[model samples]
Target: MSEPLVKEYSNGEVTIVWKPDLCIHSGICLRGLPKVFNLKQRPWVQPEKANSDQIVALVRECPSKALSVKGVRFKEKDNSDVKVTLIPGGPILIKGGATVTERNHKQVHRETVAFCRCKRSRKFPYCDGTHAQPKED
Candidate 1:
């Protein structure tokens, strides 16, 4: 497969880093703050439309590592502990210094993994944000 596309949108204070290949299209960013993530608009992301703090919070909730915030970092914490968050109708985000291995001990992402719970993701095991796509009407 080809390399994933990484896009960046900025409000000067903060930039939203988007990785389309890793995205599960959960729509959390758009739903949480439409002004910044309106799909109807050109470029789709308007980081200037919202405050950096709000944008950062929403991006952290992205199941896939697709949406991430730049220009912000928290004080060092004990990240040796693993963390997981399940989206309402999407993937499960497993993060924080994790070493994921398959049954044969083949390694996957060392720190983060987004597992598809919806079973419709073309990307399989990893989420491609397919859950966010509107079903055919």
Candidate 2:
């Protein structure tokens, strides 16, 4: 596999790192912080529009893990106890550094992974945050 394309936007205090290849185009970032993440803008991400804490919080909600924060290191915790949470009509959030393997026996290596629940994701198995969209009657 080749190296993923990474773009970084800075606001002096913190930097927002975006990896396009990893992004499934989930609109979570835009929904979470419209001022910072504008799709129509030349540079979609404007980190300066918001503070570091707010930015980091929104980044964590990114279903694809494409949006990440730099300059802030979260302290590592003992991940012996894993947690699988259902995001209330959204995806199934798996945390605690668990290993996920596909039916084909391929192991998915990631700190966390969001499994699709509503079953409307363009990217199957993983959530692209499509569940947040309004249902068609």
Model 2: per-residue lDDT, tens digit, 28-133? 7887899999988869999999998899888877878788888665554455678889899989998876676576767778778899988899988899988988
* lDDT string, candidate 1, 1-137, tens digits: 87778899999999999898898876767778998898899899999998988988888777777888775654444565788999899999987756664656576666778889988899787789999998666
The residue pairs that clash in candidate 1, if any, are: 24-128, 24-129, 25-129
TM-score of each: 0.53, 0.54
Off by over 4 Å in 1: 71-137
CA lDDT of each prediction against the hidden true structure: 0.82, 0.85
